[model samples]
Target: MHHRGFDDSCGLECVENGHDSNKFSLLCSGSAVTYASFSSQNESKAKLASSAAPDSGATKGGSATKIAWEDTFEVAMQRARTEKKPIMIDFYTDWCGVCKQMDADVFPKKDVITESDKWVSIKINAEKRPDVAGAYGVTGYPTIVFAEGTGKPLSVIPGYSPSTEFVGLMREARAKWKPEAAA
Candidate 1:
């Protein structure tokens, strides 16, 4: 007979040799085992930790704002055109689990936010902006669209991605659609 032991916090099992009829035994297991670890307020926390104090002269909510964008499509379009930056439109719904996960896991990462600053980022509520979502054919939550120039679609990324992959996606978009000088 063979025996195995593990600490209280660890998750491990003991198994007899292949010759034995019974395959294995779970000797010890962890109290909590989650596939994903993140929270909705993660973005706000990350921005607060990474961004500096807002300057008195700073316009609008300043750099510390999470999901930095305006609700108005016209304003977003104007910013994209005048800033000569690529537009990144995020299609999301408040009730979506995956969308919340994206906000918690992906958007909070320093690299994702930093790289996103180069583009004219916008967030469109799938429910409130159903026309925009329909126009872009966004059939899923957390759909990300990289638009080149004014109102020109370049690429669409659908679904929730981890921080590293999300950063890579943004980098790829930047490479494919270089930003023009700000007006």
Candidate 2:
């Protein structure tokens, strides 16, 4: 994988491959060479955008409504337990294109935000929180797991989904979740 337009500060050279035109390789200042998939390139772009403008909710079209992400999984779990709402855990990696797409396109939509308000929405970096990711059996990027406050999973959605489809999935999770079952 090769990516273009990395900041000059990093002094990274983007090299295009003949075999896989979609993929690219990044040569750092030193002898280190890193290969990135097409999807990973998108993720890198998203990360750059996020870090460049920390307060800007910049999207493809314009500014987007940001979701109020919880600080930690434990905090979200406690809030869910207290509010009697199911926990919506987003398992994602920084280098996932689909995850970046969801953040930029699907998650900021009005329908998604409104539907998600009923649950304790939490976003976890799978790489950072390997323990939680391992416990939930999350093997893919952009995995949405709906679980009870007690951390029992009711539904798991893998991959990127449109806003309408995502809302339907949320409804199904809500319908299947039983607060009393957590006891």
Candidate 3:
């Protein structure tokens, strides 16, 4: 199968030739947006590779955020339990434009990254993890579910949320597990 992508900046796009267990990606202008096959198993490494790119965004003190997203639900749940934080699971699909947009625009922003620290962040390919997605009752692309450390969902952001709005949502969802908020 052949996939096509349209970026407002770069109209030239491809979703990768055919499909493979491994993903295919292209770096537009060396640092713009990444056009690739997004999968849970490899996106972590992709994050590492992209961290050094020009548009990768930086945290406070200029440290590059590297590999912060958990690749799977099970790992994210474990981290949520260990850190005593809520879980933010991003259920996305390869063909979802909003999902790719969020990956390129929202998830890498400094504010979103900072707010994400309050929860255990994860990226789940809904097509790859239909069981998990179905269990969460996710019927849309880019269904971001904020759940307790125990994995009970508290709230959801069902579609594309820009960085500014996304940060607020993250703050609200994360607050659910806070001691003061819980009390």
Candidate 4:
């Protein structure tokens, strides 16, 4: 559902159909909306903002994958448990400047993408996943955490890094969490 020109503190409510997978896309005109929802039936809701949604030609690699925190916890856990590959959780906020810098200067680069493909990549909004952020002790924006499991914390790379440096960090990520070593 798209909402434009909403108030700064406006709230939203959503209801999902149990039979069908509920896919929700919400767009706000500016950064002035507050969305709230309650479900009567037991159903999961995945929200993608207009700004965060993939744009045309933004990502060069076709295989660059993105998973929100809420939907992929189980898959993340299973990957960590079965494959023994650590998870890289990117704690980013939509409006954060450094996060955008990392997205542009580091994450989408060929080297970073190639290196990141070795492990599970999760893009988590700190606003959305406060618990995960707190669990990892994330104190700032664009904090990257490498963990052997979803709930476990291993190593952290804070602040913005260029592509090459970020690749080195990924290598360190591999070294720190041997489970996430390149495949």
- Cα lDDT, all candidates: 0.61, 0.70, 0.64, 0.55
Off by over 4 Å in 4: 1-71, 180-183
lDDT, model 1: 0.61
Candidates, ranked, lDDT: 2, 3, 1, 4
In candidate 3, the residue pairs with backbone N, CA or C atoms under 3 Å apart (3 or more residues apart, or in different chains) clash, namely none
The regions of model 3 sitting more than 4 angstroms off are: 1-67, 178-183
Give the TM-score ranking, best first.
Answer: 2, 1, 3, 4
**TM-score of candidate 1 against the unseen true structure:** 0.63
Which scores better on TM-score, 2 or 4? 2
TM-scores for all candidates: the values are 0.63, 0.65, 0.63, 0.59
For candidate 3, the lDDT comes to: 0.64
Q: Candidate 4's residue-wise lDDT over 1-183, tens digit each?
A: 342222233232332224433322122332212222223212212222222432223322227552223234556677656656677777878765446556654666777766766666677788888987887778666788877754566678765555776788778867766543322
Which stretches of candidate 2 lie above 4 Å from their native place? 1-65
